[model samples]
Target: MSLDAPYIARAAKPGQFVQIRCNDSFEPLLRRPFSIHRVKGEGSRVKDIEILYEVVGKGTEILAGKKEGDFIDVLGPLGNGFILPRTTNHERRTTNSEPRAIIIAGGIGAAPLVYLAEELTKKKIKTIILIGAKTKNLILCEKDFKKATPEVYISTDDGTYGSQGFVSKLFHKILKTTESKFETIVYVCGPHGMLKCIVDICQERKFECHASLEEKMACGIGVCLGCAVKTKSGIKLACKDGPVFNASELIW
Candidate 1:
């Protein structure tokens, strides 16, 4: 998933994504969108970019077969990224005033949060990643998350992982019972059902939350309107206006 795309790496931001075509063939004409998994560099120079993916169908199966040194087609650093917290002028030397950002992901949806957490941690913002799956083997990105923050929590619907229920439940517990000196801000990305549940919980508690959405995107750019998602404001293109949006903006 790593590519030597310095241009993209330098411009890449947390929650920003790339669209990649599997091959030169016209069979699968459209490019697939993937979150920027990680970025590597120093100062303003970037060396590489990576993406996390799962093979769910034919297109992904083709993507999985890519070999090393293979020439791939990609379009990237697209869409708006997460808005990171900033330190106050008087306390600029200290990053303690930043909110404790909670990142929630389900199944393969964990793809985007890695870079998000990386960006947040770089700003000295406290982050806790909550990952959920149907089973232990289904859980993704725990080790990677650990590399970004030690506060990674997990759960599985079948009780085969760290917790024995939905990750949303665990988040509710943390929001209600856990004691933290900093404020809380929740970020989520997952299936519709899962998002509905989490948003419901956030609404009930009046917690601030943001969500990243995935939809069928034929054109990575704004044209075609293939991936329009209904939001509270109106119809917005997931590939253009978002992929990331406030929880209040989402209708569901």
Candidate 2:
């Protein structure tokens, strides 16, 4: 048996995420947000969508142990806009040139990055991915991302695999060393602290940045109002409004 959700695939976008209720009952009550990793099949007949997750606590631990056929309740394709450059309706400008993008993932954050990378490739945008984990085993989908982007960098805090440092450290180094201004957009997903640090760096360096946030969510939709983040505009629900937001807009 395989887990299935037909509606989600139709609605998902890069940088958006879903909230999944893993248990049969409401003991856990809240749904957990996971980045839409990738779409597995084609068209209206999509077989499944992949979601990358880490076993951090009760919710994710249960999800991690699920068998292939297991069914889980999920709500999503939630969030605000993705990082795609806005095209104005007034301007009928079209260009063959592809936009360049950089994706940074920390630990399980790589889950969403994988899906976003695939989407960027389909749009013919150039992509680069940098992922970090404690060790090589924790690094997910290195080969898959390599297929989507010409450049892929992996870093492990323990030096057991790729570069030996935090993922942000590698990102700063790349920003400093790269001669070509090939990077126009930056997307990041990770722990709150990590995300905050990256957002700060982007702000200081004047880079366009979007970040996926993690929070305790009671309802996957807007009904619960449990997962709220303070933004420049006001409070926004992470489930309905975003698991993703412009780095500058967040109060973090």
Taking all chains together, each candidate's TM-score versus the true structure is 0.93, 0.87
How high a TM-score does candidate 1 get?
Answer: 0.93
Error of 2 at 205 (Å): 1.9
lDDT of 1 by residue, 1-252 (tens): 889999899988888899998888986878889999888777777779998888987778998998899989889889887766545546433466456788999998898888888888888888888999999998988998898899888999999888889988888776766666565678888888898898888787666778888888988788989899888889999988888888888876
List of clashing residue pairs for candidate 1: none
Model 2 lDDT-worst window of ten: 89-98
lDDT of 2 by residue, 1-252 (tens): 134777887777777777788798776666777778887777778757778766778887888778877778877777763667533334212343234678998887877778788878877777779888889898988988999987898899999998998888888888787644444578998877788888888888777798988777776677788888999999998877788788889996
Pairing residues by index, what is the TM-score of model 2?
0.87
